[model samples]
Target: MARLETAYGPLPTDPGEQSRLFYKIYSAYSDRVGVLDAHGSYLAARDIGIINLILFILLPGFAWWATADVYRAAMYACALFSAYVLTAAAAQVYGVRLVENVLAAASADHD
Candidate 1:
């Protein structure tokens, strides 16, 4: 698959004959990311309530600076990023399960 960069983000353009399959995967990934971003707002709210938003950013922000030569800030930021990924993954799993269950029930009724 070939990659194409647009206003939204990177997308697979050269799907060859499997464009549909490629798009299905991409759509799922996009949905997961969207869910993560939506849920991350709750986390942001909590951080804001505690006034730890800056602290969170600054702790590593400073540690990153203090360490020098390397990007400690990015590493610390990665901790939050990993959390977002896990959150997204869990939501996606739940979504898939919900869809499967619904489909199974519908099929059982028809049969």
Candidate 2:
């Protein structure tokens, strides 16, 4: 597989180093543009819709159908919400990495 190129050379194999390098490049590119802001807004809107669906529809239905207890449903919702937030955060980081790679690739090609 082809390795990703950046200003610092090939992407690091170590997870910690990779994250640092990606953020470094991403910051440089984002400082010149509003890509991060746009992406964040998009994610925020999507999260709002997902949260609404979970709290308003799914939680109520789950409570009525399975638990028949407000407390149990609330606990379940909290766990589910926590998991969703973690997944969303991971997705956001992955998205930023993708954008960073694209920008870095383009910059490498341009130069």
Considering every candidate listed, which one attains the maximal lDDT? 2
RMSD values, in order shown: 12.5, 6.8
Q: Residue-wise lDDT of candidate 2 within 2-39, one digit each (tens)? A: 33453467767999997797677666666443565555
Where model 1 places Cα greater than 4 Å from the true spot, the runs are 1-72
Candidate 1: tens digits of C-alpha lDDT, residues 1-111: 112222224543565734564444445543454444544554554444344434555576676678773566777767755655655555565655544443333334343
Model 2 C-alpha lDDT versus the unseen true structure: 0.63
RMSD of 1: 12.5
Model 2 RMSD in angstroms: 6.8
Lowest lDDT block of 10, candidate 2: 1-10
lDDT score of residue 71 within candidate 2:
77
* Per-prediction TM-score: 0.36, 0.46
lDDT agreement with native, every candidate: 0.49, 0.63
